[model samples]
Target: MKNDRGNSSGSKSWGMMALFLITGAVLGGILGEFAANSSFLTGVAPYLVKQFPIFDLPPVTVNLYVIKFVLGFALYPNLMSILGIIAAIVLFRRF
Candidate 1:
């Protein structure tokens, strides 16, 4: 019975973890931007602010004479974003 309860909650926990990770990445990116502009951290700003594209889905267009639909996806993870993901995992585990 205890094992069954754990399994059921695991799915929800995974969802929450993803949410936290995304939130952390966004917040960290914003912070990274500010840090990049600050004079005090100029030495390390360049490294932290650099962005590398992990994946980029070419835009696909569907035209039907009257309208068109475009779809695409991309992932560019910077150093700060990676840090954010790690921080998010740590925070989630702590809670």
Candidate 2:
């Protein structure tokens, strides 16, 4: 086996960390939206109904809209980033 100085363990660690960060961000957004009583389905449900003229349901409440925006746009993104960085540090330390 040739000793490849070009392929350092740190590079692998960083790559793994980046992957974790991305996943964390996505999960955080989803979870935050859920916690805030937001629905990915509901958000687009009205538009679909309008376009297709099916499921004649009322518009989503303002409270839900507020919650969803807060969670999906504000809280989740920041939390995810923080969590991702922490996770990366922990994982890197282990390796």
Candidate 3:
């Protein structure tokens, strides 16, 4: 008899990647904002404080047989967020 099992490392899901990126982006943005506010990192402050094109999804209202739902999502990407994303990619690859 042969053992059956999927590759442990290859089994990582998309959700994990999303979580990692999101966490990194939020933390990096917070740190960047704080750094910019303190006027210490003025050199890179412009890049840290500025956000690129924001992604806004219009709210969706749906009613189905006495059920109602509303959902929406938005993404605000900044330089720090971009850096965080790159870090995430590097981390994902290393794992």
Which candidate comes out best when scored by lDDT? Answer: 1
Pairs that clash in candidate 2: none
RMSD of each: 2.9, 16.2, 4.0
Over 1-95, each residue of candidate 2 has an lDDT whose tens digit, in order, gives 32354555445545766787676656644544454454656664333222212234444434665475222222323443455456656765675
Point out the worst 10-residue segment of candidate 2 by lDDT. 45-54
lDDT (Cα) of model 1: 0.87
| Candidate 3 ranges with C-alpha deviation above 4 Å | 1-9, 61-70
Model 3 whole-model lDDT (C-alpha atoms): 0.78
- List per-prediction Cα lDDT, in the order shown: 0.87, 0.49, 0.78
Query: Candidate 3 on 1-95: residue-level lDDT in tens?
Result: 32233445456668878988888788778877887887668887887868876889989999896999999988878888788778887897677
TM-score of each: 0.82, 0.36, 0.69
lDDT, candidate 1, 1-95, per-residue tens: 23564755434377888999998898889889999999999999999989999999999999999999999999997889889989998998776
Decreasing lDDT order of the candidates: 1, 3, 2
Error of 2 at 30 (Å): 1.5
